[model samples]
Target chain A: MSSIKPLVAVLCAGVLGLQGCASERSETALDQAAASFQAVKDDSNVLRSAPRDVIRAGESLARAERLSSYVGSGADVRHYAYLSQRYSEIAREHSNLVLNQERLAKLELERQRLQLALREAKLVSVQQQGKWLEAQIVSLATTQSDRGLVMTLGDVLFDTGQAELKNSASRTVLKLVQFLQLNPRRVVRIEGYTDSTGTPEDNLTLSRDRAQAVADMLVDLGVDEKRIQVEGYGDQYPIEANASERGRAQNRRVEIVFSDEKGHLGAPR
Target chain B: MALLALAGCATDPAPHEQMRLSEQALEQAKAVGATDEVAELKLAEDKLARARSNMASESYRDARLRAEQAELDARLAEARVLTLKSQEQLSLLQSRVNRLRKQLGEQQ
Candidate 1:
């Protein structure tokens, strides 16, 4: 086949040299070309379908038009037409693969964008709820020393020298739990601290007990068991100088810390 | 091959050509030893010798430091000689003033 092509090219060159470019090489093929494939040329299919077949068809048509000009110039010039057809087929195959890859890449990018958007939306919702709950923190630890939410105990939550929660304390804690439910993703650390006057060990024990009691209330309210961390500091870290009774009362309180992002505070039981 | 070629250029001077920069500094300082600067240079040189010996026994950091101190001493000896000449001129001027003061007192 390779040897035949050069021979045909030499013949055509010789013939064209004899006559001018306008002279017809043959009468039959000189008229016009009919569409090669009977398949309906669906334009939409070309744009929307795999680009391989359409591109191949296009290449075939171009080659045929070229060969139509050189019909009688050689015997079985159709071989060159076939080679050109192969080129179209190759183009079509590669183009289809590229299109499919592009489509898949776009879908994956869209999925990632949606996931990011969903995460941001959830974060916004949780932040809004935290801010709302912050408004509900009334009986907060009096002196604003550190950053975490400091809840004040309005005597309705506890009795003198008692680490147990009052019924009212339970009610307020339930409300807190509901607010926390809005952002259940974080773990809550419960700390109990007291005024500066008891046996160091006893105060430590009392603070611990009070913190645990609050944790218990939260647990019963369906908060995650693992998320509720309880610790007691006894009568140590006073918000104000423990020189006064008011300052001592101010120091006695419980604190809750939330440490997760998804608002799914529901640790396994 | 390259290292050998360069080694041929590496040569040490004769013993007398070996400059005792530290001792020379000491002598010039004695020539004008009234200046405290010369004493300070001698003290610094002594300290450097101590540092070098200590450094040679794997005390590399200390040895490098003592070598630096020795350089400072050599410079200090030269400064001391200059200071002594300046002081000598000042002393002669003071004596002239004292002699004039005695004349003034006797005539009065």
Candidate 2:
């Protein structure tokens, strides 16, 4: 009977000790997990975009609280609390990811919009400049061809039998220079033609000399020599009959052709 | 007496292997930027420090348990870092795709 009494005392002490240990088990981890879950729940983005994650986090927090409320299971409480904390973190990260994705999409759209606007602005500027250049060369008989802008200088600009340009042609040449300056990307080709009055060889030499003279003048006016191409067709491409004086006058001329923005001239068609 | 003490020393439960493993895990986690990205990494580091202190005080059993816990926490930190990094990479790729779609739409 005395031995039974000591065994009962020992059982009571063990029970009390278990109670004390359970009471002393820290609730800090569970409390922190609960707070983290609450913060995620309160965030509007998380609520709107991460409803499942928030729900899971809430469930995990509940599980952690249950584990902590139990007696003699401190390790279980800590394990569940860690899981709950991770779930809350995942909820927040998911919400942030969605928000950041949206922001990235918006930024990309804005970039594309700006790029399009810039392209359009550049195109409009080119069109307006073309129109202005066209107006400036009205007296020079400018025409748009597949080869690009063509400005023709009549025989009146040069001496009757010589290759020198007349002094009065300075105004037109200056205007051409201004157009070239405004559109610096464009290149020019100078082609000289003559009437069929002389031998083909003589006509070729004269035509070639006249084209070279014009190219030199352009180069002297600050145009890059590499950007100018000079060629003489002689009597090969006369626009009018060489039998009449008026036709011959029309045939003797110099043509200045402007290339495209990339300095590409279309082949003669 | 000395022989008995040597026998007791041989049975020391400080878990040197577990402590080394935990240290290695923590080093790997830190190398991957887990300390900055994962809150659990700091917790693991604290536990590891406690484990070392306990080993110094000759509390071998507690040191072994804490080392094991610390190793688990460090591994968790490594996993979380990978998850976050993958999420970031996915978002970046999605953004790039969005830009490509915009460009194709414009071209059409």
Best model number under TM-score: 2
Cα deviation of A122, candidate 2, in Å:
3.7
Worst 10 residues of 1 chain A by lDDT: A31-40
DockQ of each: 0.00, 0.02
- Residue-level error in angstroms, candidate 2, position A146: 27
Candidate 2 per-residue C-alpha lDDT over A1-269 given as tens digits, one digit per residue, 9 for 90 to 100: 46654554455347656444432334678778889998989999988877876887787677667655444455556656766676677667667667766766676676666667656665456566666875786556556645577888888988977988788778888878767766788788898999999899998888878888788888888888888888888898888999999999999988898887788876643
Q: RMSD of each candidate?
A: 39.3, 14.5
Candidate 1 local lDDT, residue A68 = 47
lDDT per residue for candidate 1 within B1-108, as digits (tens), equals: 223222332332222211244345545655655244456566656755665564445444334334434433544454444544544544554455455445444433
| Clash count, candidate 2 | 0
What local distance difference test score does each model get? 0.53, 0.74
Q: TM-score for all predictions?
A: 0.33, 0.40
